[model samples]
Target: MKDDKKTDKPLKRQETEKTQQLAEHTADSTGELMNTNHGVRINDDQNSLKAGERGSSLLEDFILREKITHFDHERIPERVVHARGSGAHGVFKAYKSMSGVTRAHFLSDESLETPVFVRFSTVAGSRGSTDLARDVRGFAVKFYTQEGNFDLVGNNMPVFFIQDAIKFPDLVHAVKPEPDNEMPQAASAHDTFWDFISLMPESAHMIMWLMSDRAIPRSYRMMEGFGVHTFRFVNAEGVSNFVKFHWKPLLGVHSVAWDEAQNISGKDPDYHRRDLWDAIESGNFPEWELGVQIVPEEDEFKFDFDLLDSTKIIPEELVPVQRIGKLTLNRNPDNFFAETEQSAFHIGHVVPGIDFTNDPLLQGRLFSYTDTQLIRLGGPNFQEIPINRPIVPVHNNQRDGYMRQTINRGKSSYNPNSLGNGYPLQAKASEGGFTSYPERIDAKKIRARSRSFFDHFSQAQLFYNSQSDPERNHMIDAFSFELGKVQSVEVRQRMLGILSLVDKGLAAAVAFALRIPVPQDPELPVNHSIPADGNLADYDPFTVDTALKASAALSMANTVKDTIKTRKIAFLAADGVDEKSLTTVKAALEGAGAIVEIISPRLNFILSEGDEQIPVNHSLLTAASVFYDAVYVPGGTNSVATIEAEADAVHFLNEAFKHCKAIAADLGAAQVLEATYFSKKIPSEFSDQTVLREGIVVGEDPKKLADQLILAISQHRFWEREKPRKVPA
Candidate 1:
């Protein structure tokens, strides 16, 4: 494989010595509790100041008063967008030095480990919202490099909802619940969102993504991240190149079904967060390959659309992403409020060798992110916050804001002061000072977008066409459902106009459900033009290029398989179970990395024939089948009889069957499988061993069945087999 992680240089131990020292002195590096902000080291924090017999509070207790006062005001404002988020600590390592491409030190070396903090969030939800909402996910990374901190504040989706930054507020307002009711707090399945989406032609591409399974990801570990807009990289030689950043999950892109996501929200509200924490705690660190698509400065305008457009992507098929470095998130936040909450990421915090582009939305984000932090963090000195502070030494002259921590020893607080021999002066370009790529501009400022951005349908068409058969069907169903909820006939019809521009067939299908006739094709400025140097049709999904077929890379079906590393499996058993068989099966599954939980009639231990007692983790009433990935039933005649008499036990099996999950059973336990839908044998043996048809594996010899069950569990779901069950897509 090519060494693709060459975009930025890494931080060496010697170069980061000062930063490491500063970090060690700060409260962030150590978890020990010492003095309060007031420098008081008085111990006992368990109880508050009280009167005789703890009947009344005392007024003379300064410690208790200060503690309560600070605690009461601890929470800062959550982000207006991306309020609900989860963050992790990681290190970024470049595959090799990328000096050939850029002068960014972090990407230019292989020996350095750049410390990183990454926060993943949903765009539309508030701080307490559910994780599985149908919305864009923010994938922002803050790298504490040798020179300074660099923030890649971006989204999971490569393309955005709109072309310009000015319309962001409008887009946000429209997508939020209707002003009158505020009915749907964090869902896109509401009227206001559909209304805005229906009218905005530019939102067509993103709509397909939001409507698709990508919106409700299975877990943050399995989703891809994109910088969203093109950025410029300038070397010391003054040569410039346009780059788009990508973070490809090593687990492969995966998402949960809409039904599963909905139920997971109710059953486990912190599903995504728990998944991440559990994975890290179990030592299964999440990893992503850092990749970048580079375009030489001269080839910037050779594409069909403007490189500055935020609502577009240079498909991997066109200019393939060169995997460069790797990012591994191994640690969870020690303190959610101090680390995850106070960590501020801004696109403007670029160090030398990396620069910006004219992408308007990016330009606006550069300002908005840092500006919002000022108010949310309570001061211009927000950078002083431990989580937000860079590892690099900050020597700016500005000082004295709210929560300021540093005590300046020198008399001079200005750069050009004779009082202290003019210390902290600006460094020249040779001393690693940042210099923007010089692209001579001589054009009049205009509110209008370039004509190159006009044809929104081509890329949407390309994406839709690029999907696999099942993926395409899911997209179609999602569009139908979202549009089906639109209360306005006009809104539904207008959206059909935009859809028609992408594919007439797709428009007609959605229109059929909305009871609206597809409107005449939307007007276009350049007759669906492709750039002279570019070929949009070359990558069309409708051709023999199909042999390269469903870019196995694009399908969630092709993700990491046969590894039950973090999969949850419920072992449904009761008293008088076959101890040897049960122990053997449980050990085998657990040894394969599956988390096994015993589900019995009661939480007490269930004793076997030889007096071997198996402690149950959950009872039938407490744990539901939906909470697990697969099911197992150990042989026990009385246990089978007991389970049959219980409604919840039967219901658990029924629900798991309806969801098309795998169920492994032996001779005695096979009676339970025969009692459910799986009693009817599947007509044909599936070539794909992972298919979960009826999910009932029977017979005395269960090793084959266990092997089959493991494979089925890895499939995530028998989505194709779902049609007969009448489960909604």
Candidate 2:
């Protein structure tokens, strides 16, 4: 077994030729002349060949025709779901062999670094939707292993909104823009969505996740990912074990406040996308630990909830995750359209040792993915796309489809043809050929769900009870915000009843906000997707009380908050700034992997105490506090006066404080803080405990202020101040 504590290094491409092969398609047009699609050097690309100076373009102008035609066909059909996305190239290396659990080469070979491409996306958004939508985020990873490509198609949340795939269409349609007017794009806060959700009790657990801080992640690098279905791992001995995959980010889970998320959407709609690209380019590679919870087949039914139920999770307390591998995303895609957009992921894509279970959701996705790809990618040969191609050589009888790139020379394409002498013979099991697990199954053909999958409210309660006070409050506020947008009073009342099942306090809170009474007994057997012939008694969901009430793993407040790496901090200053104080704090922050940018009242440069010109990253007019993780104000007689006078500068501090972000100011710059709305709430004295509790650091000494600021920033936020004191930006 490889050493678990060994530091992971960047993957070297010298071990495989696949990375180099992709380079051939990568184009850099630096210092290059414009050319046509045929690579013909063009000297007059600015203007098309015209009859005289002002006439219609000639039909003979192949350049114009080719350019226009290519441009017209550039866009392919966006995905029905997860339409907006960002992708990156990376490598996955196992920490130790997992031969006992499975025979998968990538998991059993510690030395091999498998190439991978991962795409992060919003589930219900369009190609142009905001990244801050309060919706589920898809976290799909495609591993280009020598055995073949394995796609772990998953989401940021461990559970999903629906148990069966049949309800997927209805769920999406309800959350998407209303069909009549197409209003409320990329949001679930609408009448249709609440109406659908209020009737679907299976969505209770997932709705808690959506309304929690998990829905609006701070960045893609700081979120936990999970394969929402239970899969099977087959060993060399033909032994099978049920598995649930997880990706625990190294940076830990974090999120922005709902109000801050709204502001960020307006300030930078591509916030997460830009952050990912910037992090990779700046050498701050994002990483995650690939973990798995393995349960013996005999122990599957030991859980209160069914393993096959997509809306439930095998809590970590019951089955702890064994993190056996590290996945590092070190390279950004060369082209968004050619790589990120073209990449295809399906849960059915698996290597030897990895196989599917009888999960109804997983079984349906196997058919849905292939069918969706056929229409969206324009053919069955979409795997031939450069981004989706496997590293291993593919040999098959299938050939000739739309946009087919392979050229075959054979007399027979059939499997049992003597003319070709069975040249493309299939490999035996010993030769790494995939063999499905030989599990016996004897069941009558039926459309009804299993009785074991009926429990829905237990895990939902567990998730709610597990959250920290701040997280719980945020969830309560989120429910209020979403249900408030709902137009139907009946839908709101029904949802409040569902909330009552999870927690009465949560239900009453949302009811108070919505100005509606929480019904003593709203309704039962709220499932609307049941078969017409099905008896309501058989379909009634059970409320199994789990042995463990609260799982620490369910709370984001318990996540790692010891590092401030890659955090962006803004230094508010202007003309005649204190150079000593500004540079001292900047050096300390940058030394700790924190990015420090100078923001002044004007663009270009700011004048220091010695009349030295100091460059500024952005002016207060263009930059907002929403774009940064924290705010710092350096002392300067003229700088502090200018910032105090500037309304935008004062608003920046106020907004940052209102968002519960860390704020630090020099003693000299206290006047500037006093101008902000939250200044009166600032404590009279500053201490280490006060700095941590309040998330505000102020000191006369630059070094001391910097030290306190670092500590405060690591805490991520001081949400305690949000409810007690609200500021208007």
Candidate 3:
């Protein structure tokens, strides 16, 4: 049999040194004889050794015992957070040399190519949880550079819910299902969550993000990533600068509507994982540009909010992101268990140039990552695993741990020994060895929260104000829905107080939805992140109104909408569909890199008006509007009549209309659309502009209709259409 993976490709992906190294450890069982773990040939594999054909299996059968033992101990411990994940192999190429900023080999050389393994996951969900949960997405990338492995472990949202790592456990427990009931899985709509959030005013900024559309990203490829905590980049001359990393998707940021996301969760729980795998398998590689916001060491204290505060972000208006490199995910993992699952990423895995900052959350994660891996991967020698090993040869004094793959031949395991003649001696900084930056520190030993981290509401207000009208409305609805699910009325009322601090109008909107009165003046000490002494004066938080009112970068309305590349467009049709009308628009969309699938009343084939047997991708009963970016209907007498009468087909159109997806139809097939719930609200006009106005296109010319549909779909969604009323399906 031919190897499809080796031959099937449109782009000629260049192999890096790391890729070749991985191939050395990769095992291929093709054309090989089956054998035991000890390489013994097994002839009778199907049946275990028995006394008399049906007798009890013998314990002396090594083959059966070996197989059972391996199977029983196969699965490893999943991550406490980000358990449900999808990974891909790729390469990163720097746009230009950045010798002035740092001495990291990957960033200093423009021509150098570094192999990368990236894992995307949803936080606060179990391994079996649905991918459409409204939560933060983990965006981690491990760069196998020539020097060593550098991991950028971050998330889709730039800021986190807590400022310090000590509160990480409390935050996770609150977001998780209740301890007694475990009623809700993969959701934060519970009393425990609101009860915690109501008192933690420090989580204000991150709460705005969690409630926004960013939490429900359209797909992994369309999401943006950011290094939540600020880090330091020390140059060759030991000049340190504060930096924030960002991964900006080329396809642009987009998300599914809340209702549509719920429907998708029910229809396809593996939506994100499947989307990433299929895109790579079909050669439609996803791409993102590596951006960075660099601030000089002297400018760290220039911002109103603290740089060490993980809950706040350095707004784009204050510091612009510079696109420094391009990261392209071109290959899916060969084995999910061996590659994706075992691909360990940690923020502390930095090369020579990169170093940590004083971010408290970051400092705690530095210790937690190694500890977590020791248990999750079975031993301290987990780095020896093929997926986690660095491309360069490792020369360390440590040895003899569980799952250790290396065989040290020397007599000396300790440093500065004459037995091995110091064969693996450490090198100096001049010889490409890492050296810690000389940062002077003279501080107290007492445990106390930084006063600089107190002004949390400034950025929260900034984020709330930065949203577009539709986005802001969606946030209000989300807050209302989540709060309404809480059983404790006090928790809901207390949360309204937190929301009121961010924006009184937002609180009023949510109060209207929940049929609860807005808090006129809530009790004091809304922040519960205080010491047991209850001395509020010493740790009281003060609010700061930022100079900038809104940031365009904070809103998805400003994201890229120029291309419909890799967008899924559903073509609704059935028997007697107009061949010309369907093919004309389908071809135009496909030519622009859109994936068009035909949905009909029946599966397999649909007869066109010209008696042509067109292939149908999915049937009306099996397919869903939640899976597609837009919907289009072709003209044909029987097709329109049949679609209008079929309950499933009409319901599909209704759901598509309700979800704010672009809907287009040929004038002859307009009757099919008119049979839907939102037909009365549909505009009578037909033009390219109307596509943008109402997200509905109806015209006689197939070419014009196709053009309008393309424009409408490029917008991702017509959020303006759902402003007035929701179409009941």
Candidate 4:
């Protein structure tokens, strides 16, 4: 007969001997009931302490007061950087067991579902800041894995503004509105920011991203997320791979134009937050695929740029990402203050099989995240907050601080104690304990960067070259507008000099737009040289190749495309409208998870067939086409005639067309489109035009209309139309 051991399941057989033995040693035998701080056995907690007369409250009620006091003071400090944000409860599931890559429990177990809390935010904005600001969006996730809570504190942009951690404070201060007047809130379109950018050459690449469409995302659900720093994924065999984390939105990356974004800020301050909350409430959960581009340790130095630099990205074309898991956000926070506000995410938090590198910016973050929490969250016990607390039981010698929740029952609260039988001792390295990889380190304590960290202009030039023709034009316009805002001519000239280093054509274009002379050459360097405090020689910026070709990954237009599930479409109608066209179009659009709003002369119920009616979501005075992805005018002879007479409706279609948004109309609605002189000056053509050729769609068939509208929305904007309009961007 076959051996019984050979026939049994591997894990089941092994658990009978090894896992059962371990569990027996760790299990607690006694059954117990949960109690309050006073350890009272009495029930009845729905009411507070009171006197028998019911007119006066009792003072000597310890249990009631204790419970109320604890509840009242439960809130802690919010994050200083990403103060205003929204979070969702989600589950992360691995696509397949990654045993071949890392030993991380979540990654190696496809069957396991790891609970996660993800927070998305806009930097340089206060808690009351508008949602549609042109700033970097923070994409932080806290994964409550079996081993520990792992926090991936990241941003929507892959590259950062500065290279070293020491410059982080300066970068933040400069990018934020000027300290003197604080004129601009949650924006980088100020003189101080441009001045800082002109001086700091390392910020060139990031500036390209900030000025692009990535900054003004339509919704938090549409933007991509990235872990900006290089991390290490180690296996059980002690082998490690350098990885960069990326979260690709299943809805696809999309954004509004600058003008549209500004208008959205004025109309709906809580645009992104409201969109996410409503989506969750409607059961249309947002999801993203967690991907990683891992480079084997031995192949680290093979790339042209240093992996240690945070201001650069190793293009996916070079090392394509391997998507290993997916994160689905299914629930919104129960309480904004209790969950979203008090949630803490630290970059230092990591589980076994995941580790940090000596990346200078990342090293600085490890210290900064923890240090900020102490001041902002009120105390070191911030982790004790329910939202930040791990699911696993925490036991250590460290104890006693402000808001300490756990009560130690044993006599010995310290480790290496005979009284408590040395319980809660630190686990050894072999038994699922976190141990740093044995990387050798030998360096002097010098306040200097490596030679490899220099040469900041090459990537900047590469980004400019990578852009499609229209994107490059937008960059030029951004520089012109930003420099024009600078009152100081010297600052503008200095900025032109910086642009010359990036691209001569770019500098010349900006100078022309501003009606100023382009600098003949960049100013001479004040400091002759600085040396690297290492075996490697100092980097020479002059020698570095400034002619490196464009990388496609640097361009947002080159990103993944084609899903319009979360796109917003506005239906323009009024009382006594065409019920058939409105119902058919809206139903088709919303069925695909698209949002449809009926915008009319007022926010009252508009009558449909059989006295039935649909509530007008927004009035003409309240809603603008800038707030939506597309606009449609249904067949309503009287409704279209009334709306066309109003200035707001005319302005709405003009703005939508100017931004290159898709617009559809039936036979009766065509009169409104033709009468509204929104884009009258815009020259139209079949393939392309000096205005929105893709914007106007007049038809009878619903399917054809839907296909055309989706195509126009995907194009993002009709920059071709912008040229003739002479709107100065």
Alpha carbon lDDT of each predicted model: 0.76, 0.89, 0.88, 0.77
TM-score of each: 0.87, 0.96, 0.96, 0.86
Better of 2 and 3 by lDDT: 2
Model 1 Cα shift for residue 235 (angstroms):
3.3
The TM-score of candidate 1 is: 0.87
Residue lDDT tens for model 1, 454-570: 656666777777676667767778888877777777667767777887778888888887777998754332122233554444312221122222234445566666576667899
Q: After superposition, how far is residue 216 of candidate 1 from its true place, in Å?
A: 0.9
Candidate rank order under lDDT: 2, 3, 4, 1
- Compared with the true structure, model 3 gives a TM-score of 0.96
**Top lDDT: which candidate number?**
2
Runs with alpha carbons beyond 4 Å of true place in candidate 4: 1-78, 526-543, 546-548, 608-612, 679-692, 725-729
Give stretches of model 1 more than 4 Å off: 1-68, 520-553, 558-562, 678-696, 727-729
The alpha-carbon deviation from the true structure for residue 57 of candidate 1, after best TM-score superposition, in angstroms, is: 7.9
**TM-score computed on alpha carbons, candidate 2:** 0.96
Measure candidate 1: CA RMSD. Answer: 5.9
lDDT of 2 at 707: 85
Model 1 clash number: 14
Compared with the true structure, the alpha-carbon lDDT of candidate 1 equals 0.76
| Poorest 10 consecutive residues by lDDT, candidate 3 | 1-10
